[model samples]
Target: MKISRVTARGFMSFDRIDLELNEGVTVVTGPNAAGKSNLGRIIDVARLTVASHAGSQRGNRLDVYERAPRHGTRRFRLAVGIELDQPWEQELIATFVRAAYASSAVELPRPAHSPNVSAERRDMDARRRLAPESVAVLLRGFLVIHYDEGARPRWRASWHHSSTGDLYEAVEPVWIMNLRNGGPLMRVKQEPSAPALSLADAWRRVFPDDQIDARTPMPEQLDFMGILKRLEHPISLRTGAHQDNLPLLDSVRDLYMLLGWDMEDARRGQVDFVHVLDVVLQRACVLTDNRRLPLARTFPLEAVGGEADLEDGSQIPCELYRLKNGPLPLRQRYQRIQARFTELVGTGFDVQATPDPERPGNLLIDVTVPEGDHEYPIAFSGAGRQEALFLSTLLGGDPGRVIVLDEPGVHIEPTLQRRLIQAPDSTTQCLVITHSADLVPVTAPGDLARIVRLAPSHDGSQAHRIGHLDPKDQTRWLQTLGPRDVRALLFSAGAVLCEGSTEVSALGTWWEGSSNPPSGANISLIDVGGDKSFGRYIEFLKAFSIPWVAIADGPALRPASDLHQQMKKQGILTATEPDSAEPDFDAWKAFWAAHNVFSLANVFGNDGTAAGEFEAYLKRLNLELLSQVDKGRSKPRIGAAFASQHPMPKEIADLYALIRDRLQPARLQDAQGEQA
Candidate 1:
């Protein structure tokens, strides 16, 4: 199953977040403490919660009240919009539903004219009618897990029948059922006094005219206890009931039991829907986090006869043993893992599981790096190599599983980080939580739509996806800013978009000496290559709600320059240029300054000099010092050295003060009030 959307309220860092996810690899990124990890936690919780209901050993470990957002609602709700694969859909209808019908406890109404038709044939007919087409109708829905302050957690699984091919637009609840902790199963009724609808009723509501077997049991008459009891011995039930009956119900009961739910609870109410939901979740989703690598690194080795065993038998480290001695599928999985590792690390990198030299028969995983001539134990490898190994094991093993990776790029180098982002195949859906600038570049051009940027807000944290922007705007953003610039702007609390490297270097040098440096305040000094692109960069920053200020050369801000036209086109400059084709320095400066664009000309020209650029302004301040710098050095490098020794220019100092004040308005306002 692939999740198309996630909605959460009063959960973790979110008071309310409705995030629509894209297929393939979606990178979730933002500033520190902006709830990037919390987004992953939410998805992981949903995965675990679904697993819990299906009877997986992985159950929800978090307390609901503790996870609720501060000063927010005590109750929390988390829901996922799921689209099932063909196989899972078939299992729900043909396997689970068909078995429900074949139970001896469920009595179906017989057709008046078809008295000779056997019950077995009628069950087969019912399943055949519900296959492919009905599967599509039933598979598009949501699985919700929610809790109230004074109540235990409850689960509601509902499906929508779509006539217009839009799942989100689907208004009718075709199948509505609820599962409560240690309580009886409840089918949601349209009215309080009315009887709750069953899956069969849902089908009839959607396809009213279609003829169905009268043998199909109603919700109230269906014997859930008898069905679950028979599920314990699926083989016997298959022979006595329908020949096509699969052991799906047995797996469901096992999952339910694994979740600590008693078999006797099946007697309380109908749980046939739980059987259907379990198969969808258990078989289709896998959530993983970066914490796996550390565990694998510290896993203790124990000698078990002639084989290697981890003391705790952790699945992650034990995967190495499985690679060496498990079944053929696992060995084949190892080959895929090795291939992926080599692809990301380099052509010469190789991973192998061989006998440990110290422990005669015990197997140990070893790696051969391109730089090293001899192989070394994996434990001795660098963290980057180890992370690559762990990630490779995850991505290469299964193509069908939906993989959720939390901060996988933390230890990998920039180049490998880019490769890792592109590693997942087209068929595998991956949700990656990352703050790495290295991973941002790979999503450009085609996959820009896959970026979901989160930021802290008044309520809690909010998510914004590039896909939500107009297609033309997304394309323009790609053309305007480089990945590094995009990363700087997206992750910073505030950004200074400078025209050239000199302004970036000089301001950065000056800011470093200040009591409140840019880094300390989470501010970014981004060189936008040239002032012509400043308007585009500003627009992109504004789109994502990132605060920004621009610094431009005096010439760039002149009425006759190309930047004036670009800024005008972007609506950043609304004033009409002077009738004469000459620089209106004062008028243009004030016009752009109102939009937070500072000009070097105004700063230096106050001394009545014709200084129109940053280099010229620096020259005016200390010509001898600027000349004494190494001629081989780049302009920015010399600029940095020059700014480090001299006092900051008054205009630049004021701009710096403005940025600091804007970032902390209340402090600035209080100081102003004291002066007043």
Candidate 2:
């Protein structure tokens, strides 16, 4: 099943956070410490062993009332909330303070007759806030796990701490295991196993030492227990000698099969195609391009044609031909497939074309296999081709797997990576973790997930959660971050976020001009015309956590001014106008008067009354005149004063001319150069 939402409170770097997940595929990413992996672990906690997962009592007793960590005050808490399709669940954490426990400074009244007393105290306004015991009690119900190798873990309770001692857990209590990046899966090497009771059990059965506690939550059977009981083996669908394999396929096939496709009820559409000598045969699905598809199969070559003898489970070589009454186009068509990619390899799949000679002249054609190398028992292929074949198999055999590729293109090459990213959706929900610029398409932004930047924290020691940024700002932030950081904060959306083109370009140029530019792909600039669009973009930014800012000018700006009330009304952007900014027309006049301009007419002109204006008067004049004057003309409008009352420079007019004609995201010759 899909994880729809996640939330964390009082945990490590995450003081409070909530992330949303969509149907099909939801990509989780952020900086190395923006807490993306922490978020992933939070979800993994939900998937731990039922009886094994436990909430820490230490997490409950953190000192309340302290805004930040202090000398004596501690804030220990672990609160998690998970949302399901229908029946959702939440966990509230609380700490406990013993009746006998007392601090010298602040005293609470106790029963006169009884020397000892116990009361459930929730202090919302205490110095540090909740009592150490108060938070502990709240943590009693949720299942949380943190993976530290030294801790002796148990199925019911993983902690050993005393209320009387000072070793209290922090506000964040998550199971943290430092796996070496991705671990040595390719090499046949394994680590030494731990020997505690549960560790022994985990080691004997090859399970993780840590797990989540189940009995603490809803009386339902624990999600992890069932998973451990069922998911006892690797996820493989090939014929196996064991009995448990049946359920593995059952779980994957049942929960994450392509949204609308059913593998069991296979249906193949028929096609009647004729090749046009003037036209080229192409495979265009709306996933990559938005063109209407033929009602039935457009070409026989495109369909997953009838079976073939897959020799020893290998990818059968069959070159697809365009029947345009000609030979092959460039072989680059096959380049669309990842070089190392081999679908249905070892899955008993194969492909080939059967030439026809009996039928009339052009009436006869060659066959193509859509389910390439997927027909079982007739082939033999090696694991070397497994990566590519796995993709083809997922696309064909299963309609499509919710391809949760954590950098599917990482181990692959550049061209293959591009092709893999561009692969037709084929009902596949692709949740890809990538930071490749090559994967980005010039015309289509569909493949791009929303951009999230992970930047440094105020405190140099531990990084803080900086916020989302606009495409322009994101580029700067990412380079400061690098590969590991950017990989974690990736996400996708359905709308276009055209932040201002000028601002985006300015930011890009400013960054490039630096001794060092930021890492990761260049930022994507969506062209939303003015601050009104910027306002909407900002709203999207806040809602989704992408960082962005819109810059609009004034004088012509009115209530229609983007920097004004509109954004504040939408609650999208904060109106942080400099105190120096005037509310109306007079502010600019005063500022311009301070300058050497002869008069208000020098800048404002007759259109000086233009409110809600975004362009400068002089720049606008140059642009208007340039539009009227052809490129070949000797002189431009120059504001109707060419060589007259204080004639203007031809450079300014020429620049405006280019601005009006060119479509570059941004163009500047450094006040001395020209557009290429």
Highest-lDDT candidate = 1
Off by over 4 Å in 2: 1-23, 29-33, 37-151, 154-404, 409-511, 516-527, 562-565, 572-676
For model 2, where is the 10-residue window of minimal lDDT? 270-279
Worst 10 residues of 1 by lDDT: 231-240
- Shift of residue 26 alpha carbon in model 2, Å: 1.3
- lDDT of the candidates, in the order given: 0.60, 0.29
Model 1's TM-score against the true structure:
0.77
- RMSD (Cα, Å) for all candidates, in order, is 8.0, 21.8
| Top candidate by TM-score | 1
User: What are the clash counts of all predictions, listed in order?
Assistant: 2, 82
- RMSD of candidate 2 to true structure, Å: 21.8
